[model samples]
Target: MITIRPSREGTAVAPVLVLAQITSLQLGSAVAKDAYDHVSPTALAGMRLTFSAMIMLVLVRPRLRQIIARQWRAVISLGLVFAAMNVAYFQAISHLQIGVASTLELLGPLMLSIVLSHRLEHLAAALLALTGVLLLTTSSASLSPLGILLGLLAGLCRAGYTVLNQQVGRLFPDWSGLAVAFAVGACVLAPVAAVTDAGAVAEHPAVLETGLGVALLSSLIPYALDMVVLRRIDTRTFGVLLALSPAAGAGVGLVVLHEHLSVRQACAIALVVLASAWSVSRSPRTAPVPSPAPVSAGDNLPIKDTEHQART
Candidate 1:
C-alpha cells in the first residue's frame, strides 16, 4: 500500500474541507427531499450517481487501461457500497426527517470507530453516542420503523464505503479511482431506478434539473472534498469530525425543510456531538506519519499514499 505523510498544510486544511463537505451535503439532502414528490428516492439516487459520474469522469479521466486487478477490485467494491448507501439513505430521508436520518445513519461510522478502537475512552465515546441514538429514537413516537431500518442499513453500507474508499485511494493515488467508482455506482443504480420509477423523471423534467443540483452539492463537491480530506487525516479522526454532521443536517432541515426537532431529540444530537468532540480531545495530538511508498519506474499504477488517510 502507498503511504503519504500528512503535510502541515494538508492537516490544517482538512477540518475546513470537512466543514464544507457536511454543509454542502446537508443542503443537497434537503433539496433532494423537496423533489421526492416528483421522483422516487431510487430514481433520484440514480440521477445523483449518474450526474456525479459524468462530472468526475470528465474531470479526472481515470486511466482505465492501466488499472490492475487488485485496484479494480477495490474500486468496484467501493462503487457497490456507494450505490447501496445512497439508495438506503435517500429512502431513509423520505420517511425520517433529514436530521434524524443523518443521526441514525451515523451509527455505521460510529460502530466502525468503536471496532477499531483499542483504548477505553473510545468505548466510552461509543456508549455516549449510543445513548444519544437511543434518546433520539425513543423521543419520536412518529418515526417510521421502515425509515429506521433503512437508515441503519445505509449506515452499514456507509461503513463499508469508508473502508473501501480509503483502499481505493491508496491503490490509485489520485481521484481516478473515485471517478471509476462513481461510474460503477451509476451503472448499478440506473437499472433499479428504471425498474422502480421509470416514468417519474420522464414526467417531471424538472427532476433532472434538481437532481443536477443535488449531484453537485451532495455527491460531486462533497465527495471530491472527501478524497482530499481522507488523504490528510486518519479514519478515526475523520469519523470524529463527522460528528458535526447531525447538527449541520438539523440546521439545514430546519431552515430548508422546516423540520422541527423536539427538545429531547435536540439533546440527543447534542450528546452525539459531545461524544465525538470528547473522542477528538482525548486522541493523540499528532499521528505518526508514515513514509511514502517508493514508486517504481515500470509500475504504471498510481502510488497509494498516507496510511493515515483512511476514513470512517
Candidate 2:
C-alpha cells in the first residue's frame, strides 16, 4: 500500500491549488452562464461531462479489467454524484446569479463538515453559514425558488462527491478512478440532455465548441486540482477551504457576466467566509495518526492519511 508522508511543500501548495481551482471553476461557471443563450443548462451540462469524459478516457485509459466490484461501486457512485451536481448547478445558475447560487450550494459541504466533526465550534460555524445563506436569500427579492432548490441539491451532491472521491482515491493508485467516474457521468447525462434539450444543440452547433472550453475550465482543471488537494487533506478541511468559492463566484459573475450583487448579499458572503475561517482556525493543529492496516491484493492502492499536517 502507498503511504503519503506530510511535507512542508505539500502543506504550502494545498491552499494555492485550492485558490487556482476556485478561480478556474468560477470562471467556467461565468462562461457557461454567458453561453446559456446558445444552449439549455441541461444540454450544456451534458456537453461538459461528455467532453471531459472523452478527454480523460483517451488520456488515462483506466484498466477496467483490474478494477474490483467494490471499486466499481465507488466510481459509479461518484459519477452519478458528478452528473447530478453539474446538472443541478447549471440549472441553478440559469435562474439565479452565479454568486448567489454558489453561496447557496456551499451549504452542503459546510453542513457536512459540521456533522462530521460534531464539535461546538463546527456547529457555530454552520449556524453562521446558515445565517449568511438566509440573509442572502431572504433579502434578495430577485432570487428564484427553483434556483434555491437546485442549488441545495447540487450542494448535497457535492458533499457526496467529496466523501466518495476520498474513497476512490484510496482504491486507485492514480487518476484511473476519476477517468472512469467522468465516463460514467457522461453516460448518465447524455440521455437527460437528449430528452430535455435535443433541439438546442442542433439549433446552436457552436455550443459544442463552447462546451469544450467549459469542460476544460469547469470540470477538468478544477476537478483535477481538487483531487490533488483532497489527497493531501481531509474532507473537513477541503469543505472549509471551499468557503472561498462564494467570493470567487461573485467576482467572476461581476467581472465576466456583469451580474452584480447588493451590499447585503456581499455581507452575507463575507459572513460565510468568516465562519469558514473560524472553523478552520478551531481545528486542532495536530491529529493522532492511525496505524496502517493490512490490505488485500484486491485493494492494493495508495491510502491518504487524513491526519496529515496538510489538513490545516
Candidate 3:
C-alpha cells in the first residue's frame, strides 16, 4: 500500500501531488490502450468500473444511508460523466496514438487547472500547456476531426470528473468518496456495456484478461495511489504530478508499445509539464474545502505531530 505522511504545520505540496497523479494516470491510459483492439472500450470501461467499485466497497464500506438525499443527483451525474469519459477516452485511444489522444485529453486538466486557478503562475503554466498542445497536435494532420472532437468531449468529461471528485473528496473523506464514486460509475456503466459488448467480450479469454489488466492499471491502482498520496501530500504537489501525464503516456507508449514520439511532441510535453508545475507552485489556497467525514479526522491532527513536514 502507498503511504500518506502528515503535512507540515504550514506547508503543502499540492503541485507535487498533481504531478504524481498525472504520471500514473497517463501510464495507466497507455496500458489500457493496448487492450482496445482486444475488446470494446465499453466492455473495458464496464469491467474497470466494476472492479473499482468492488475494491472500493470492500475497503471503505461507506455508509450510503448517511449520504444526503440532495447529493444523489450530483452523484448520479458524476457517475454518468465518469462512465462516458472512461469509455470515450478508451475508444479514442483505439483510433489515436497514445501521444496524440493523451495530449488532447490533457486539455481538460490544463483548462481546469487554469479556470479554477487564479494564480499568475498557474495561468502562465496553462498558457505554456496550450502552446505545447498545439505543437504536439499540429505535427500530425492524420488526426480525424471527429476523433479530435471526441477527444475534446472526453477532456470535458474528465474535467467534470475532476470537479466531482474534488467535491467528493471534500464531502466524503479518505477513500470513501472515491469508493462511492466508483460504485456509482460501475452501476451506471455495467448495464450499458453489457448491452453493447454482449457476448463478444466474453468468448475471448485473451480479451477478458487484457480488459481486466486494463481495468486494474487504469482505475484501481492509480486511484488508490492518488488517495494515499493526497492524504499524505498537498494540492500543489498533486498538480505537479498531474503535469507529468503526457510524458508518462509517451514513455509508456514508446517503451511498451514501441511507439516513438517526435522531437516536437517531446518538447511540447516537457514545456507543459514544467509550466504546470511552475504555476501550481505559486498558487495559494482560497479556503479549505471540507474534508469528508471519513478522511476529515486526519486533517485535524495537531501541528506538533507534523513538525517540519510537507505543506497542508
**Using TM-score as the measure, which candidate wins?**
1
Question: Using TM-score as the measure, what is the rank order of every candidate, best first?
Answer: 1, 2, 3
- List the candidates' TM-scores in order: 0.89, 0.87, 0.81
| CA lDDT of every candidate | 0.81, 0.81, 0.67
In terms of lDDT, the poorest run of 10 residues in model 2 is 286-295
Superior by TM-score: candidate 1 or candidate 3:
1
Worst 10 residues of 1 by lDDT: 288-297
User: How displaced is residue 260 in candidate 2, in Å?
Assistant: 1.0
lDDT of 3 by residue, 79-177 (tens): 778788888787777777777777778777667776755666666777787788878878777878877877888878877766665445545545656
Q: List runs of model 3 lying over 4 Å from the truth.
A: 1-16, 225-241, 285-290, 294-312
RMSD of 2: 4.0
